[model samples]
Target: MLDLNSSDDSSKRNSLKDPISLNVGGEIYTTTLDTLTRCRDSMLGAMFTGQIPTLRDNCGNIFIDRDGKVFRYILNYLRSGFLDLPDCFSELTLLRREADFFQIRPLLEEIRRYETSVPLGLRGGPLGAILIVKVDSKVRVLHFNLRHGPENYELRTCSVRAFTVDLFCTWRAFLALLCERFSYKTTQGLTSPNPCHPRQNRLKLEWVPRPDELPQEQYDKQNYRGLTVSSPEATWSDDIVNMQCSPCEITDMQGFVEELLKISLAEGFKVDLVTPDPTEILTCTSLRLVKS
Candidate 1:
């Protein structure tokens, strides 16, 4: 006589190798029992292997009372041995819950990895940024000597002055725009002067000439060969003024402030406050943006 227990085992193995239909939250999915049982310690594996009882829908498909839409990803992970989600996928927490219910350790681990890899800015949530614009003025003293007839004359003068403006930031997109337009460098782990605040990354905005613009050395050489030798102090002062006042493809500080506001608004940030709000000034000395 044939061994009855051996025959039963052979039948169970054949059944697990066959195609299985699943009804997950009214969504129908057709997959293989082998895929479902791939994770031997998972709930799906236990159910399919007869270790746990399973319910069936009217159409004879296994009924899972979980989210069917997210189950596709779950099944795909089981089939492909990897996790892949769309860039716009926003159901991380929901998917994690389903993974936990299914007892899929690998899928949970993959989700944790994705969470760690994605930037906090990309994730939808409330965030904040502080913008500070510092302005300073410097005075230069100059002395001139002249000879009048037979007498020597000495003149003391303050011929030129300079104004410097710098922008500091903690916003990612704003910092990126500053870097792209002004060649600013981002500094990480920067702490505020106040000891109470936590350490954070920061960036400073200082204008740098684009590739199309004349290089500093070349410009200096051209100035030296010109009809009048331009003072280095005067040239530096002129550049600072032009960068603040003139507008050329958002090269000016005012244009940059406008772009910052536009970008922040588009990214769901609202202006929280402005320093010295005496008038409707676009380029405020300090600004705070909050997103909710």
Candidate 2:
């Protein structure tokens, strides 16, 4: 909606500038805002939309950092244009994500740099060696276990792989936890008569942060973190088995999908929220629909 011939046209360097008031964690910051917010918002939104919340890593403590907090950092940045982040805060993925979404380019770069530069301790379970995924590649996948533990990252060379995807996608942990708990396997690449076939698999993962809720306390002795999975045996009805597998992972594929995946897929394509009509736009790769 811009008039190319307006005063804030290509001729003016600062004409498109606008002052923005931001409430970052509690403090206030007024800065010259850029149009990149729109682009950043859309990009970040697409990357995280429809994610399973519990599956997200809880580095909640990082928001406050070890010594400096978000509000402190924001205030410092606003007053003197300095980013005084603690070692902890700088390593957080979510903060980096937020920074990118807000078009804080320097902050984004700092976060990425901090991840490789900061030295971390030998904590975090799945215990040792965790992948610092830059992008998805064979090195990241085959060497996953070695990459998992938090590291004392003094200074590391980050190849372009850091930008692509990770060694393994986040979904791997979800799959592992699911299979370990459910005693089930995946149906990754089977073709259907309809190549654009849809698959919707939902399972409830029940966990207790403390020990007592678990039936067995042995895992507690090692501080297995009181983690245990309830049986998926009863969660799926006879129908779900049909879709996930020829017999559903728990039931049969067609029948299982028709009941759950198909219904959910159909619901996603429903364009008319007030009415029952919706444009059934199938995801080109898969016959998937997401109404919202």
Candidate 3:
């Protein structure tokens, strides 16, 4: 609740004073009333509206209990309505924290946009250059960035007019390997609407061809499965389809990725697989990949 008299009293005080001084964590900042109240839903706005009492330090400046160093950026945002980081400023995470504390929606959005920027090299595989595969579930979809020697590959559920039979065969062989080595079981049951099994459960496990420019929301929805193998020098040339190994070679997907990372690192390639979940990271020395 705001007292009308308090508002009038504060207005009178401001009329007789210079630019308001804010002592935020022992740091002094000066700004005008209009700028501070521009975002009416913010805490500063509430303070100006008399809903919250303003506290002052001993030096006769309103005191805010927060980081003095990053306060400049917050004040700058309020003044100019722009988020321009200093040239040497690498403290985005810190600034974002402050923005969140201040409940600034635009500033938080800017931080999110900055954080999701992808690396130049790792942008979705060269368009149409490699087959793209996606596995969908009730909650999300997983994309595979599969490779074979210098050639890249993606999983395919059915033949397409543009792609050749060899690509299909390679993908089929990869499935065969997964079945034999990992003991992967496809979903099996008759469709509720008919007598035919209709590949109902198998549909979830099979890799479906992915189109270029996958939906942004889809990528955000699920974790990605990636492999980082040693570069030109290593002998891990065999693709997932032809990688000769006994059942002991890997226990599961995580184990398989771990073994691949271990082999690649021993050969001196710093391959990294980026995934949304840390628990999904493989056991090998491969570094956890992040997009931002």
Candidate 4:
């Protein structure tokens, strides 16, 4: 009698060399049996080598219950022996879970390496900027041009000033950037309540002006004197008016915003969205950035 075991082994070897079709969660994939069995100790290897039982769909394709969209990455990793993902891909945790289920140690390790290589701010989640500009009480000065008769031709001049009082950011990398480049100091630690990422740590930064900087009152006086000297036709009453003004601590909130956008773009971040639209004002209440 012919050796049935020897004949069966020969047939199995021939099947392993042929192309295999797989239906993973209703998604169809075709590859060679050699690729599936490349990692001898993996779940896929055991299934293809007949060590683990597998079921086939009615269409005669091997069926696997898994996420079909994510399986593309798994198949590509097995084929190329390397993991390559897009720069904007954010589903790393899901991919890691799938790799664990398949018992692919190498893939899991590669994902770990990728996570470590990413920037600290991006590793946590999307980067966001929250800035609030506060304007102090304004001082108005009125000049009466008596030369124009009882019409009281009054010239009204008002100076408005604003400063950044509260600056909050969701990413530490951005906070570090501000501290390194713009001389911002950490004022306090804040915990922001986010629906998606609850209890996330937010940072509040402050920039205090140096004592050498001119006070707001002196600056205003110099500006008014310059205006008086420049206009020879303008007449002023003997009433010497002095308006009360607060000391200047912060002056250029807009400048800070400009530098922030510039550096963020240079560091491979794209603007996700801004509140109140950019056309309305240079300073925004909220801004979000994402890594490319």
TM-score of each: 0.40, 0.24, 0.40, 0.40
Cα displacement (angstroms), candidate 4, residue 252, comes to 44
State the lDDT of candidate 3 residue by residue for 235-267, as single tens digits. 223321111333232223344455434432322
Off by over 4 Å in 4: 1-17, 120-292
Predicted candidate 1: what Cα RMSD to the true structure?
20.5
What is candidate 2's TM-score against the reference? 0.24
Between candidates 2 and 4, name the one with more favorable lDDT. 4
* Per-residue lDDT of candidate 4, residues 184-234 (tens digit): 222322222122222343433333232223344443443321100010122
TM-score of 3: 0.40
Better of 3 and 4 by lDDT: 4
Q: Put down candidate 2 lDDT per residue, 169-253, tens digits, no spaces.
A: 1222322333333322212322121111113222222111222322233223323221222222222354222112222332222
lDDT string, candidate 1, 1-292, tens digits: 1111232354654554467888899899999877998999999988777776667676777788898998999999999999888764645556766887898877877776676677644432225555555543344444444345678665533233333445555544444333333322112311122111223435543332222333334333322111101111111342221112222333344555666666556444566777667264475666666653
lDDT of 2 at 31: 44
Order candidates by lDDT, high to low. Answer: 1, 4, 3, 2
Lowest summed lDDT across 10 adjacent residues in model 1 is found at 225-234
**Top-lDDT candidate index:** 1
Clashing residue pairs, backbone N/CA/C < 3 A, model 4? none
**How many residue-pair clashes does candidate 4 contain?**
0
lDDT of 2: 0.29
Whole-model lDDT for model 3 versus the true structure? 0.44
